[model samples]
Target: MESYTGKSIFQKVAVGRIFYYEKNENIVKRNRIEETEGEIKRFEAAKLVALGQLDRIYQKALKEVGEDNAAVFEVHKMMMEDEDYLESIHSMVREQKVNAEYAVAMTGDNFAKMFSQMDDEYMKARAADVKDISERLVSVLLGNGTDMGALKEPVILVADDLAPSETVQLDKSKILAFVTRYGSSNSHTAILARTMNIPAVIGVDISKEWNGKMAAVDGYTGTVYIEPDFDCMERMKNRIAEDEKKRQLMQELKGKETVTKAGRKIHLYANIGNVADTVSALQNDAEGIGLFRSEFLYLEAKDFPSEEEQFQAYKTVAESMGGKKVIIRTLDIGADKQVDYFNLDKEDNPAMGYRAIRICLSQPEIFRTQLRAILRASSFGNISIMFPMIISVKEVREAKRILEEVKEELKEKEVPYQDVETGIMIETPAAVFESGELAKEVDFFSIGTNDLTQYTLAIDRQNPKLDHIYDPHHPAVLKAIKMVVDNAHEHGAWVGICGELGADLTLTKTFVEMGLDELSVSPSFVLPVRNEICNL
Candidate 1:
């Protein structure tokens, strides 16, 4: 191999390393059947040490960052201590008489092989789970930590996979982009990465082939280019300059009203999860908090949070916004995001079955607790309650009934409260059809286009086979959105959209044309969206 040249003409090569966890682990050659008991014990000892290290890391994060900020580390801690995973490792060691290293190495190799062979993109990305666990194990075993100091300059981080803890600890300013060998655009890491407004690429293959190769990744276009010819690099440079110019202009527009270049008024808002997210929203110059998904209150707790707990969480977000409108969706949990506390009954078609309002109706106590919490929080700042997945006027009436009941209870307890505006999310076609009727009862309406598209098209957005049918721009989806907006407006209720479709530049004008009063999207989209709105 005196003269070896192996390269592809691809524009961008993903970066990763060929990590071999099997190295130094006494793996008897497959052909040799030597005793592996001692090696197995050593592997088990390594596993124990790794798990213990995870606990220490979790504690360190908890001490460095508050409990809420260290949620990712907490999740990792739970995963490491999960009985099933621990039992699996112990069982493998006992059954095979091999050490923990061999078990983990074989598990990683097998999973990588299985995922690599899978045709489904979503499932294939799960191979990153294997990579994640293996990476942590390797990191603990060899103590070969990739010092964060090496990335002194602001540049993109290209890797095979990134744990949530890693993402949380990353210095956002130094990271311009995040490209991974395996991930979906909808994955949690991608979600957080998007919030940081750093360009990211996921599901990239052959990342290890590009080690030490300088490349530029365009997260917007999902493109990566290795050492490119001057022409391409020049083009990229010009694009970057243009982008910077546009960004500077947008920065100047911050704190100004979201009015179109034509002087037409449009509302710009942030869709946030918790109090921490409101910080990003305000930073992006969001006029208001349009969609405060209430699921986080449920997800981050060991049990159902008490009404007081929920109230404080809601109040924190509302008070943080300082009178900015915050539309809190009521307990939008079921089906897709089942909570440990609220265990939904398995359904043949969960997407169409008991979810959101359906689940709330069956468990009014839970719904009442949340309603009570929202009302109490309302005393602190501007907050509106939006009932998710309401398909009929009946659900609206029932929710309002529960609200009044909570009001009476609060009054009886002499607790301070505020009168909150009630709204419903028009996400199902049935709900869109009845928007006029629902709007008459509700104070406002928010179109949840994500679910509307899936329900109208009868396609599971997460299903790989039907992902194409999950188009939000389908004419039918547009019609549903238009109908809901018109109905809500005709009924003298403000209508807005809190969906991925809202912030997309391609559809922003279409939404404007459709008469969407407010568009709530991820904070990262705020600047670009505002720029687009100004030019509109």
Candidate 2:
């Protein structure tokens, strides 16, 4: 018998396949009708029906966000009214002389193809929306409803990416886990997965070939097992048991300070999006809110929110946290989050393009609006303003100048506000290299490991082919993080982390050893990570 016993410990596991929509498949029997170079009332009626259905769904989702965050819905409304898209659809129908049913189908099929060719994952996923929207219109033309009830139950959802609509409509209670073929770590689906505390693996191979077989999904390792034998099943079972036990033990550490076994105190913080998310953070007994992304403020508004409107939004969160630290990041929008109303142009590589501090510098008015709101709310509780994608000292000085201007304006107007601390996200390679110098100017530092890892490694996070090259555990990445923390501390500033890696179980000890001041992760991970820190 051949002996096959000597082997290294397993580095990673493959448990599933990612499924992407086959958008290239040609539509059959696409009936073409002769056109008369004019708008057809029948096609217009079908478009109206589709828009109306979208409106109903939008209103329902808006209520969950409240009046403050309802601006995002307004953008969706505008998207439906995009004149170019409407014109294209009309041209296709009039020239092809097809019925409204076939017209909608062809348009959807064609749009999906166009979207898939884009470099952005967000735009690519938007292709699915095009397909879905057109299909619904076709259903209306056919005198039928798009029934999702036929969706198979108790099966893992596989897709190139999942949109907010698909995620919200899914029977959350029945989903075991979802795997996507493509998406950034901060993509909407990944954010929803963390918010929902569901196990999910993105940018992986997910297919139906393993139907009727148990596939062990390891969200932490980003792997899936297909048709595992008895031994593999037992090993995965043991791993699951261990994970559960760890979680149970971590629950006991809730509401307690994360003091290490060696008497080192580490702050545990929550990374939240909007005010609605603060409830979960507090429920988890977090020390404070470390990274409160302010992009949502700009995303949901019909227009630029008045300072007062922005103030109230910030005030709600401050009051909820009382005296706890709330590090609110300034508007971080740019290339990817294209708000056409703002006249922001789409870029080939938005991540590396003009965004964050760059946008704020160009449009001081927008930055001032957010800064004024944050400063006004500061009086209510602890609040800090953090600038993202900080690469130059000039941007820092300019941002500070704007804040000062806001303060002076508020003072002249006799508005009540508190003086606040300012900080920068040390995510770029340049920022890390200059931490020693930059630390002297900022109140503190928050290491955004996601971008830091990507930029430092010179890898596009969305590229699965280069996934092997993107390593947060590599010696170089670890050294960069340590350099930032050490330099920040040396300059008399504290440093915290607001990246996904901050929540990793294995890295907790490494961070503790490095003497990190705080860890801000998803609210659900607070208890477990704090527990790990406490027992360190």
lDDT of 1 at 380: 94
Question: In model 1, which runs have C-alpha deviations exceeding 4 angstroms?
Answer: 1-174, 181-184, 227-237, 261-263, 345-348
Name the lDDT value of residue 481 in candidate 1: 89
lDDT (10s digit) by residue, model 2, range 250-354:
777776778999999988899998888899998888889999998777755535768888889899999999899999999888644544356665355778998
**Reference-based lDDT, each prediction:** 0.71, 0.73
Question: Per-residue alpha-carbon lDDT of model 1 for 1-536, expressed as tens digits?
Answer: 01112211112222222221111333322222145566555554444445444544554465578667656554554555556655655566667765555566666666567877799997787567555665566554443342233455666566655544344345666666666665444545566676766566666653455545556665445666665556656766777777777768778878878777778788889999877888889988998898999997876564788998998989998898899888999988866565544655545576788888888888898899898899899999999999998888998998898889899999999989887888888888899888889889988888888888888998776453464456788999999888988998899999998988888899888888888889999987887788888888
Q: Candidates' TM-scores? A: 0.71, 0.71
Off by over 4 Å in 2: 1-79, 82-155, 168-174, 181-188, 202-245
Clashes of each: 7, 15
TM-score between candidate 1 and the true structure: 0.71
